[model samples]
Target: MMGGSAYENVGKKWDLGVEEQEWFHGLLPRVEAERLLIEDGDFLIDDDNSILEMVNQYCLSGRPWLDNSDIVLKNPIFREKWLLQNDDIILDRKLGKGYFGDVNKGIYKPMGNAVAVKTCKETFTQEQTKTLLTEGRILKQYAHPNIVRLIGIAAQRQPVLIVMEFVEGGDLLNHLKKQQKPFTSQQLIKMCDDIASGMAYLESKNCVHKELAARNCLVGNGLVVKVSDFGLSRDKVVHTMSDKNKPIPWKWSAPEVLLNGK
Candidate 1:
């Protein structure tokens, strides 16, 4: 579900603090302009203001802006070759192509904070665009340490980048196969229990994680488990794109999403 763009959130309601409301009221007319804007970590109403801050701090090294001509993105000192750019550091790896975009390991900078960034393609159908936006919002809301936290997002017409905490230990599928050592029943039980603990948190928030395969989980040293990838996660949003325009990503999604909850 796509909530109305922050642009359209003016008349409905706001979860903003009182001070935030004052800031919002200062630009009442701008919000009503029907244009979407996010600047300086704070959203703006109009696009005419060109000096928007690079709030998407988690960019490819330094190349943060899109450059279609060069087939790269340029920031201050870096030039990300598109594939190398992710919210988390790509660490110069080639993961694979994904439904919404591609997957790559990215450097989460400042040391001790490696992250994996999900880079999505820019060209999207009306439905795909809606899915992308909603997917990002849900990612930002998940607060558990076991869940990959969304750092930030960079959006353009064709390429969108989602920065998230990178799990260095890799996912469960690779770990399971790479380490092929048989685990005792107790170990498996502990693994399952850890997963349930994480899911239980998501459930307490009235959320459901429909996709729970071995591949989605990540295991670090000391057997710490964290879940990654939520491309199919959904919840109620104020429906920005009409149902007629909403398109669902079904490759990894089940039949229910394709049918829009029947």
Candidate 2:
């Protein structure tokens, strides 16, 4: 058996001391640990009995032989993206409104860039608040050109805001309907390709976009399409239905999903 300070906690409970540290991410998968190590020298301890560190161009682990068989880290995780000050966001006109809250076209002062600021309703329940924040947490893990990027969240005050990239052309469904000229075959193909690419990335991350539809996607400049609105997205590869009363877009759902509610 491999023995020493390295293999001591293989099957035992995770060390309490390790759990108390902010860098300690208990029981995280190899892919996830690498995702978090975005910057050079960035490191985190996981329950795999190893310390995974990013070294500019290589992902080296304390026990390389045990878990360095696949994948490489490039983009570093930014934890500061989670919390934001209310003062940094300047809310403008409303872009859209939904059941949970309003998404305003705002300016995030730090970056001085246009952003879609999503705010939850004041009457939100505890469960509703959790779901709103959960969406932010899920979106943080995703980084792709075909996927809408999350800027940050301003949750320091009453109206918690979720700041995201403001796609110029707006929602795909609306964009398609409002087009003065019909999209050419090439344009249509490009849009489909963009959506497929984003979905493929989500699949690789073992995530399911429960509500994948034109309405949930956004059109950016140059007619580029990006998958957006991940409030209904799940992290699991296979999700079984449990909430029978939950509302879903029946028209956009797959046959299997419509029949089995999965």
Candidate 3:
């Protein structure tokens, strides 16, 4: 898509901030961590910037992550469980996520049961806000079991709140791991079936998840899987980029979207 490119791993060597270091290690392999070789503290985000610009154009987007792939995970966005009152049970408080509140898995107190919470952290941007609102409204319109459900939105202060059905089983990536407990080839095929079914539903509704990837597909307690992470998705027209376009998680993107260095 226009304004987006495969991300570069310019400064993957820097230490993740004290706040973000833990989660950073959990998601990455040590070999992947060691390959990082850039220093990105000098990058910045400017207005009129595209998603790729917000990330790749500046070091913040690429910092601490090595050997850039299309899956651009930077800027831990979720910091704590303060979004809820004392009764909340946070399943996960993600960190260093970009442009949106650090996403989390937990239960809203007043509203019982497991649900996903996307807090609108400082990273929340106009572009991301647009994506969040659009995705939420779209998700609400459908009642499909294949897609994650949006029960309600907290939409309070800064980190806007989005309440969704908490997917029990980990993402497809985790399920793919664990040699002693890995899914069988048949199970993998079934996962593909569930994902396809969800995508067909999304397509029928004219939704476009521009950043689709294995992780974006949410898997339930060993039973269901659905597409997620709405920020890179679109509900409107998308086009080409300028000649100097920067990239985002490159491995996740199509090659043409990347601009050759001018």
Among these predicted structures, which one has the highest lDDT? 2
Clashing pairs in 2: 38-75, 38-76
Tell me the tens digit of each residue's lDDT in model 3 across 162-238.
67777877566665664367667888788889888877887787665556678777778756887777665544343
lDDT of 1 by residue, 190-261 (tens): 778878888777767655554666788888767778877776455534332245454654444444445554
6-122, model 2: which lDDT tens digit per residue? 222333333534433334444333545666666543555544344332321143233333364534332323325455666778999999996569989999898888999899887
Ranking by TM-score: 2, 1, 3
Question: Where's the lowest-lDDT run of ten residues in candidate 2?
Answer: 1-10
What TM-score against the true fold does each predicted structure earn? 0.58, 0.67, 0.54
Q: Which has the better lDDT: candidate 1, or candidate 2?
A: 2
Stretches of candidate 3 exceeding 4 Å from the true structure: 1-98, 123-131, 237-262
The reply for model 1, stretches above 4 Å from the true place, is 1-91, 108-113, 156-158, 236-262
C-alpha RMSD of each candidate structure in angstroms: 14.2, 11.4, 18.9
Task: Give the per-residue Cα lDDT of candidate 3 at 152.
Answer: 60
